[model samples]
Target: MRLRGVLLPAAVLSLTMLAALPLPSCIPQSTPPQPPPPAQPPPPLEVTNPILSGDFADPSVLRVGEDYWAAATSSEWAPHFPLLHSKDLLHWEVVGPIFQTAPTWSEGNYWAPELAQDKGRYFVFYTARQKGGPLCVAVATAAQPSGPYTDHGPLVCQELGSIDGALIRDENDTLYLVWKEDGNSRSLPTPIWAQPLSEDGTRLIGAPTQILMNDSPWEGQLVEGPHLIKRNGWFYMFYAGSACCGRDCNYAVGVARSRKLLGGWEKNPLNPIMKSNESWKCPGHGSVVTDTQGRDYFLYHAYRATDFVYVGRQGLLDEIQWAEDGWPTINGRRGPGGKVLAKPAAFSEDFTSSSLATGWVWPNGRQPTTSVEAGLLSLSPPADRAADPIGAVFARSTNAGNYTAETVLDVSGLPAGMAAGLSAFGDPENALGVYVRSGKVEVWHRERNTHEVLTSLDAPTSADGKLRLRMTAKDGQTYRFAVSPEDTTWTEVGPELSGAYLPPWDRGVRVALTAGGVAGASARFDSLRITPN
Candidate 1:
C-alpha cells in the first residue's frame, strides 16, 4: 500500500538507510485508541402529579432551604389545615396540622390556607367561619412548619364573607393581604381585593382596594383564590373562577397582570388558562412555589377522574412556564395531571411509640381517647362522647382509587354491645367496617346515621385474642372485608358491598381504626398498614 504522506525526498532511499533508521524508534506513531467513557445514566425523575395523594384542596406551599412544606383545607376536620412536607415534591408525609384544636373563634368550615415565611418565622393565612357568623380570613403564626400556632383570628370578616387570603410584598417590602369577597353565595358578582397588612401581618391597615372581578363571561359570578408573584417588572396575579367544588364544579384558573399590587390590572386574552385534562378534572385553587433552581411550580388540587370526587380534590403539581409574551402557563397550557408518577407515600404504623403520631385525625373537636405504649395502641371513647355514633376513631387519608387497609387487633375483651375494627370512613354518618364483638365477626355499614350488619359470622378464636382485618377497595366504590387468624390465610367476611354512599361532596374516604361501644369499653391494636394499588 502506498503511504499518502511519504515524499521520500522525491528520490528512492537505499534499503540499507531505511533499515538502519534507529529501528523505527525515532518516528512518530498514531495515538493508541481509548475506550469511550462509560455512558452516564440520565438523572432520575424527581417530581410527579398529585404531589399529595388525598383531599389536600387549596394547597399553599413554601420552600425553606431545599425543603418544601404544604398546607391544605381541612373542611370540617380539626386539628385543622393539614400540613405536609417533601424533599422531592413527589413523596410527602403529614407533619401535623396548623392547629391541634380548631380555633375557638372559628366554628367549622376551614378552607383555603396560604403558607408563607418571612425572616425566621412561618405564617399561615387561612379562611374559617366565625362562630355564628360569616366566613372570614384569619392568620396564624408558628415558629416552625409543624407548629403550635398562635391564631390572630378573623383579620377580615366582611359582610359578604372573606375567603382565600394570600400575601404579597411591594418593592418597598411593605406587605399586603389579597383576598376574595364571597359574594357568589348571594348571587352577587365576586371581587378580588388587596389591602395593606401591618408590618407584623396581624391586622389590615388601609382600606381594601378592588384588584379584579368577574368581568369576563368565563369568570361567571365568582373569582377567588388569588395568588400573586412579581416578575419582569409586572405583578402577575393567579386566581380561579366559577363554581369551585362538587360534581358539577366548573373550576378553572385565570391570570392578570398589573404595574402595582392593586390597579390597572389586565386579564390575559387566554383566560381560564388551566382547565381539566384527561387524568384530572376541575383543576383550580393553587399556590405557586419556587424551587431552589429558580423554577416555579403550581401546587394545586384536582379531582381524579377515575375515582371522581370520592377521594376529594388531591394535591397536584405542575411546572409553570413563561411564554415569549411574558404570560405564565401551567404544564404548557395542556392543563393538569397526565404525568408519569411514582405512587404516593405508603403509611404504616407499628404502635411502638409512647405518643401517637400527628397524622391521626378525628372529628373537628371530638378528641379521641387513645394511648400507645409497648407496641400496642388502645382506644376508647370519652364518657361524654358515648352519644356520638363514631365514638373513638383515628384515621388517615388514602391516596388511590384502589387500595388495601389492614390492621391487627385483639378483640376478645370486647363486650356484647361493643365493637372495634378497621374502617373505610367518610364521616361519622358514612362508613364501612369489619368488626368483632362477643365471639362474632360482622361486616357493618353506616348510612345516614343508620347502622346495618351486612353479614355476621362466628368469631375466629385465638389463644391470644389476636385477629387480623382487611378492607380492599376496588373501582373506588366497591369494597370487601376479610379476617385472619394471625397467619397467612384470610377468609372473606361478607359479600362485596357498595361504598358509593361513603363520600360526601367535600371530603375523601379515610382508612380508620374505630371503636364504638358502651361506657369504658376499649380496643387494642397491634399494628396497621396501607398499600395503594
Candidate 2:
C-alpha cells in the first residue's frame, strides 16, 4: 500500500468557529435544579496491557538517568514528528513537539529525529525541508529533557537530500553525526554519511564522508533510519532497508561496523536480522539504546498481517548480542517477540498539575489554552494557533492492549458553540474523540486529519456544570466513549472509533477543549484523569 500525505482541511477551523460560544455561570442559584450525583471512580491507572499497535516505525530512544526519551518520523503530515518518553521502557507518554512554533519550512516532510542529552541540555536533530529546497537537519535544545525546545541552528543544507540523522559525542568530547542521503530520486540509492560537529555541538565542521552504501539485494530497494552507536571500541551503524509498503516492502534491520567515525565499515555477515511476513514483514527502522544496566537493546515497529489488509503495528524489543565477530544479533534471530524483554520503569502519579508529562504531543500544533487551578484544568476557545484549534493530551502506548482515559469536565460555563472533549491522538489525521458541544454531545473520528462525526448527544443543561467523560481504547485503533453528569445516569455516546496508529515520530494524543470557529470562548475541566484501561 502506498502511504499518502494528508492535510487537515481548513474546514475544521470553520467547525471549531461555528461551535465557539461563551458559557454562562451555573444555572441561577435561586432556580437551582438538583443535578444527579457522580459515578463511582474507575480502577487505578495500571498497565494491564500493551499500548501500541500497527506501523510504529523509525523509533529513536534516549535514556537519561532514570528517564527515557524517544522520537519518530511522521512523513507527509504537517507539524510532522513524534516525541515520546518513558521512565521504564514499558510506559510511554507524549510530552511535546520539536517545533510548536509554526514550522518555518517543513514543505517536503519529516523523517526520524534523533534525541540526545549532552551535558545537562537536551537536543533533537531532525530533518525538514529548507525554505528554498531539499531536506536539512534543524537542531532544537532545551534545559530540561522534555522541552519547550527552541531551534538554535540548521545544518546539511544545499544539495543534500537528507533524512534520518543522529548525533554522538565521543569520550574526549568529540561530536559526530551520521545520516542517510536519499539522493533526490526518492529511491534506496541513499548512502549513509558521517561528519564531525563543532565545539558547541551545533554545525558541521567538515565535509561528510560516505561510510556505507546499500548493496545487498534486501537493501537495494531502500536503506533508511540510520542510527549510530559506539560500544566496545566499535562504531556500529544500525539502519533499515528494502521497500516500505506493500507485501513486498521487505523492511528489516541491518548493521555495519567501523573502527573510526568515518571508515571502511563491514556489513554484518548476518544482515537483516529482523524481517516480516516471509518472517514478520516490514520490520525496519530500528533504534538502539543502552539501558541503565548498560545492556544493549533494540526498539522498532513492524506489521503483522493476518487474513486481509489491516494497518496496525506493535512496538517490539530485543536484546543485542555479539556474534563473536563483534556483529550484533537480535534475540538469536527469533526477533523482538521471541525474546523475554526486561521491563523499563513505571509512570508516576505525582505529575505537575500544569505541565504535561515529559514526552507527549498534540496533533496539528494544538496546545493548552486553559490554566490549572485547584487541580482543575481550564481551556480557552480554539484560537488559530497551529492548524487545528482542538487541543489534546497524550502518553506513549506502553504496550499493545487495552487502555482508558476519563476526566470530569465542567462545560456549563461554556459558550453555546464551544465544546469540552477528550481525544486519543496518533497524528493530526488519525485519532478518536468524545466531546460535548453546542449543548449536544458527539464522537469524532479521523483517518489522517480528516474527520467524521460518528455520534451525537442531546443533554440539555441550564449551567451548573460537570460532565464526567470516559474513553476506552481497545489496543490503538478502536475506541469507545461515554459521558455522565450523575452517578446513576451513564450515556454511551458512541461505539468504538476506527483509525490508524500514529508513530512516536508523528505525534501522540491529548485531551482538549475547543471552539469551532473564531469565537475563542473558553471551557473548564475540573478533574482530568487518564489510566490504562
Candidate 3:
C-alpha cells in the first residue's frame, strides 16, 4: 500500500503535530532557581586559663536556668563575700556581693562562701571569725543570688574551729553541710566533717561526723575545702589538701567516694586529681557544675608560677569528663594553662557609672567620708585616730600578676602631716605607699609594723595643684614608682621594691588610693587606670 505517496511540506507536518499535542498550560515546567541556604555563624573564640583574671579563690559555683552564679573567699575584704555571675563558663562579672557589710558578730576574715537555692530562696554557707572567737561556719539567707544577705549566726561546731562550709541536698531532699576543722591552730590533722542541716538550711540538726582526714603524704598539714556531688548513685566528696598560703603553698585537690552519704568513704586510688604543675601553683579548692548541654566543668583557683607570688590565687576553668568506672577526670588532667578553651558568651558591665567599680572592696568597710563624684574618687581620713590604715584604704584587687596602675592626685591644701597617693597595700604593717607629704613626694615601705622612707624627691610643681603618680608592678616581683609634673614626662622616684615580702595570708596586695592623717585630711583621685603588663 504505497497508497498515499502524497508529499506534505515540513512546515505543515510540524504545525499538524503541534496542534495535536496538549496545551502549554498542561505541560510540566522546571523549578525556578532557589536561593542558597543562609550562612552559619562562626564558633566563639576559645579562652585560656585563669578565665577570671583576679583574686578569686575557693570558687563555688551554682547553675540556675541559663545563669551561673559563683561565690569566692574575700578574706578581710568588705563587701564581705564576692558574688560573680556568668552566662557561659568562660566570662564573668561581679554582681555586687553576698553581704554589703560583714556580720555584726564577725569581725573580719570572711572566707569560702558556698551558694545554693531552695524553694526560690538563696542561702550562703560561709566561714568567718567571730568577734574575738574562733573561726566557724555560718549561714546567711537572701531573696536573690546577688544578696543583701542576713546573717543567722554561727553553725554548731561544738566549740571546735571550723571553716569551708559546703552544702549538698540528696535525691530524697535531705540536706547536709560539710566543713573543715581548723587544725592549723592545734598542729593536729585537719579533718572533714559532715552534719545534717535543717530544711531551711539555717541550722545544724545532728552531731557532726568526721568523714576524712589528712592521711596521705600529699595532704601535708590540712585536708580542707570539702565539696560534695552525686553521680551514678555514688556520693563523691572533693577536698583540698596541703598548705593554702605563702610560698610553700602545695595545695591539691583529691576525691573520695561513698555509697552512703555519711559512711564508708573510700579515697580515690589516684589521689590528688588536680595539683600544681610548672605553670600553675597550688591548684586546689575547686567546685563543679554541669552546663545546659550536659557538659561538666570545674572551677578552681591557682597562683601563676612566676617570681611574683603576690598576685594571689586567680580563678581558673577546665572541662571535666567521666570514665567508665564512674569517676570524674579533668580533660587536660595536668593543670589549666596553654590550652585554649571555648569562651562563654560576652557580658556587659558599666565600670564608670559608680564611684567605685563593683569589683572594688575595702579591707574592713567603706569609710563614710569616701565619696565618688563625676568620675573622681575622694578619700578622707577617718575621724577616729585609733583606726587602722587598712580600714581607710580604698582599693581594688590586682586582676593580673603584672600590671601598671596610674592615677592623677589633687593633693592641694594638704596639711603638714597628711599624705595621699597610691599604695600597694597588704595590711597595716605590710605595704608600700608613694605619696606627697610636706610638699615633697616620698616612697615609704612598711614591714612588720616598722615604716621606713625608701626615697624622697621634690614634688612636681604643677600650677593646677595635681600630681601624676604611676606604679608599675613588673612580673609580680618588683614595683617601680614614678611622678610626673605635666602627666607626660615621668621621673623615677624610688628604688625598685621587693614584692615577695607581701605574703599570701594577707590575700596578696591591693592597689589603692589612700589618704591618711588626722581629721579633715582629704585626697582627690582622678584618671585612675590599671593596665595589664
Please provide TM-scores, in order, for all candidate models, with all chains considered together: 0.87, 0.69, 0.86
Evaluated at residue 528, the lDDT of candidate 3 is 69
lDDT score at residue 40, model 3, on the 0-100 scale? 73
Q: What is the lDDT of candidate 3?
A: 0.77
Scored by lDDT, model 1 comes in at: 0.84
Instruction: List per-prediction Cα lDDT, in the order shown.
Output: 0.84, 0.62, 0.77
lDDT of 3 by residue, 1-533 (tens): 12289677888888888899877876887789999999774442355877776678888898988999999999877777788899987788888888887788888778888887778988888988888888889999988777778889899543558898888875567888888888766888788888889998888987888888889998888898888888888999888888887787888888899888778999887778888887788888888888887776788888877633577788888777678887777644676654532321221222345645687767675543677676566677567731333236777777665778888887666667677788888866678878887788889888887878789888979878788888888776679999997878899997899866765473877887777764666667766677776
Query: What's the residue-level lDDT of 167 in candidate 2?
Result: 81
Where model 3 places Cα greater than 4 Å from the true spot, the runs are: 1-45, 158-160, 337-354, 365-368, 385-391
Off by over 4 Å in 1: 1-46, 144-146, 171-173, 387-389
Cα error, candidate 1, residue 323 (Å)? 1.8
Prediction 2 global C-alpha lDDT: 0.62
Candidate 1: 10-residue stretch with minimal lDDT: 7-16
Q: In what order do the candidates fall by TM-score, top score first?
A: 1, 3, 2
lDDT of 1 by residue, 70-182 (tens): 89988877678888888877678788788888888988889999998777887899999999999999999889876778999989999989999998897677899999999
